[model samples]
Target chain A: MSGAFISFQDATKDYGSVRVVENLNLDIARGEFVSLLGPSGSGKTTLLMMLAGFESVSGGTITLDGKVINDLPTYKRDMGVVFQNYALFPHMTVARNVAFPLEMRGEAKAVTAAKVKKALDMVQLGQLADRLPGQLSGGQQQRVALARALVFEPRVVLMDEPLGALDKQLREQMQLDIRELHHRLGLTVIFVTHDQDEALTMSDRIAIFNHGKIQQCAAPREVYDHPANRFVAEFIGETNLLDCKVSENAGETFSVTLDDGSVVAAHGLPGLVAGDRALLSLRPERIEILPAETDATATGQNRLAGEILDTIYQGDHLRVVIETAVGQIIARTDRKAQEWPVRARVMLTFRAADGWVIAP
Target chain B: MMAMSLFKSVYATLIVGFLVAPLLVVLPLAFTSGAFLTYPIPSYSFRWFSELVENTVWSRAILNSLLIAGSTTVVATLLGTLAALGLRARNLVLSSQIRTLFLLPMVVPAVVLGVGMQALFVRFGINSTYLSVIVAHSVIAIPFVVISVSGALGGIDRRVERAAESLGARPHKVFFLVTLPLAMPGVASGAALAFATSLDEVVLTLFVAGPNQRTLARQMFSTLRENISPAIASAAFVIIVGTILVALLLLLMRRRSA
Candidate 1:
């Protein structure tokens, strides 16, 4: 949070009676590529639009570089923005589109040309400078949009699902290219997307949003490893939540009794009492599956007995659905392991610290 | 099957002949060697065309009509485009009402508009002058431009303008840079239609234009009253062809741009 480049201080946006973004407060550091990741109707795009000055700030101020820019016009605020549709001017050539901001700012023609060339070269589109937007492919047009946003050397860039229009392979390639460009230019970027993998791959920090609220904002690894709430835990990745009752509470660690009368120990839960009911979030990949005849007498903090209901081969991994006494749980295992047929009995084991209990 | 297609072809040709007969009659009559307006049997000659060019009154009238039509096109196109932009964004109750009011000139009977315009011009002390004619022409032209440009604006993606604004262009810049260029074809077609409408206007011109501001249509009407000259037929032929050519050019421009 030190020396933050863009700060949303208690920002709230309202449309009539519905509040789209409510009480959002976060500090995005300089040169940090952060993503506002959420589903449709989650107000993540609304928040990004407000920062880009397309939407009015119904309440609270958005400050950039210690200056309150909420009242400033979009152009005066000096920020670059790439839209979801890659809104390149159809009438302008690639070079002209990239030079638009410089022209608006009254830069010298020579300076504009040089900067435009550099930006297009950065996106590896220098040879296509004279082509119109309609003449280029979707991926190429998106790169032109990125180049246009970067040509003026704006302090911050806002991208609204910039890669949403591309195919899977091209989207992945552009993700890396954009990330590399961000690193080379050292510009603050606020990327908005609904794709979790894209956010995980490109963002330095990720803000998980739900119901117009930021559930957690931290380093990508931190958010993935230690999600702040139930929404964050389930949203960041695949998780298996087991309904359980708190059987014992000792200091920071607690023992929970599952529906099938099995007890599991976990740590780092707050406000847990002996009778409290909670959901234990266990990542599917974190669970270790063993053969049915494997030694059950071995010491283990958490274990479950189940029958394999289904096995799905997902290229390098196998997704096995086990119907335990508590409920159905999914475990991801390497495909190279011995295959377990359907209806086969199995034992699932994991360390106690692997599961975190979230309140109902 | 060949007989059926031949019948269909004959029917289609008859329909086209029905549409084009009046224009066909006028074109050849313009080149008639006879002094009177008759079309069946006449030697082809440039006598009428030469007379149309030589007559100062007729040539001046044609020039005046061109000036009026050109100015009216410019004024109506600008105002109509502005009105369309306002209507698209504002959609305010008053603006909508005003738009409907502006369209009244198109729907109202030409005689009624002419009489009303004449009275209004007299009261304002500018009757039968070039300004009065230009105003009357613009009143008819604005609605065409408005409807055409508005259709184009509606087809455009508003996201492009928003994208431009977010990428550091102001509202005005977005309109000029993105909205206007995208809508150019529609605006051009609208202007062409306005020019043709003004050029062919007779009732309004007769009521509002002064002696010095006589338009080609008004002159043709006067010539018809005094004498049935082949020169008037020649002028009619030129006006009809010119309007068609302008319309075709507008269509071609739209196609090329597309």
Candidate 2:
């Protein structure tokens, strides 16, 4: 958090009796791309809106460049914003739309024209600059929106679900395009989206939000591997959450007894104690099917006896659902790997280090 | 299916024919060689058309109508566009209530409104002045402006204004550069509609206007009561032409904007 360029110090928002965004304290480094990932009504978009000055912070301050900018109007905030709907001015051509910000700032006409051309060129939309927004496809309109926001040379860019309206392929391409732009310009960006895959794909760091709170904020791999709590673990990827009490707790590892009287040893994630009720988060990809006797004789890996209920062939992998003694568990494996039919009796094995324990 | 569509087109043509039958009957009579209103063996002439321009009463009524309708258009367009903007303002309380109030004239009985306005104007001692006629016409005309402009505003994405604001344009700049240009089609149509509404208004003019402010509609009403002159037919022709021009303008603006 040191040498942070943009910081939200205990910022909060309220709508009469409902407090949508609680005290949110986050520091985004200069030239960093951070995404706020959450479900609908999770206040991720609200936080981005607050930063862009579209919404006011109910308490505390949002500082940019070591100065508080909480009360600055949107026009004076000097931050670029790409809305979810693109929100292009329908009457203006693409070029005029990009030039609007420069005109607003009273920049010289020559400089404005040069910069507009450059921005449109950056988006590869220079050829279509004369077309109105309605004439462009969804992806083209999005690029125009991006160009307009970037043409002003704002220090920070905020995007609120900018790709939500696009098809999957176009969305992915835009994600990469935005990522490349961020890298090329070294621009600080705060992206908001409900899609976990999108956040993981585009963000250098992600803040997982739920109920107006940041449950976890870390690098993609860090959050995936060692989620801060059950919500983070479940929200970020597919995982089988096993409800079990802590049978034993050491500094780095623990053991838990499943409801079916099965004892499973597991590594811990910094905050579990003996006799505490904890849920063991086992990722689907981390579990592998094994022969029953080999799993029983295994020394260190955690094991579960199950009967395969179904095997779904996803494009790249197979999602196998199994009914174990405790409950249902989902395991995702390579589609070309060893086959498991329905009613297949198998033992599931996962390394103890892969089993994460979270209390509540 | 083709036959059914043919039947539908024929039905539509019949309805349109019924609607234009009066115009078809009167327009040719304006150029009638004979003095009678009947259409048996009448040849075509421009005598009535010339009479319409030559007669002082008819010419003065046309001038008065133009003046009043033009003023009503300006006043109604301004008031209605302003009211529409106010309705769109954030944090405005009872916005729909205000909108309903603006649209009330469209639904209220014309005679009732004329009577009420006549009483009010008389109390103010401006009962039969040009101001009274212009005000009454503008009041009814405002609803057209409001509806058209509001429809234009509705098609606009509100976020576009916010986008403008975010891009360093202030509120006024957003309104002028973003909201205003986007809603131009609606405003143009609203102005044209308001002008047409004022031109055709007769009941309110009769109640509030004096002889000096007698519009073409008032003149036509009185002439119909006395004798069905071909001069009235020529006046109707002028009105039809004016309305067609305005309607054409509205259509052109819509297509251009679209």
lDDT of 1: 0.88
**Using lDDT as the measure, which candidate wins?**
2
Counting clashing residue pairs in each candidate, in order, gives 0, 0
Best by DockQ: 2
lDDT of 1 by residue, A150-223 (tens): 88888889999999989999999999999889888898999999999999999999998999999888888878
DockQ, computed on Cα atoms, for candidate 2: 0.80
Best by TM-score: 2
DockQ of each: 0.68, 0.80
| lDDT values for all models | 0.88, 0.91
* Weakest lDDT window of 10 consecutive positions for candidate 1 chain A: A292-301
At residue A326, give the lDDT of candidate 2. 82
Total residue pair clashes for candidate 1: 0
- Clashing residue pairs, candidate 2? none
Docking class of 2: high
Q: What is the TM-score of chain B alone in each candidate?
A: 0.92, 0.96
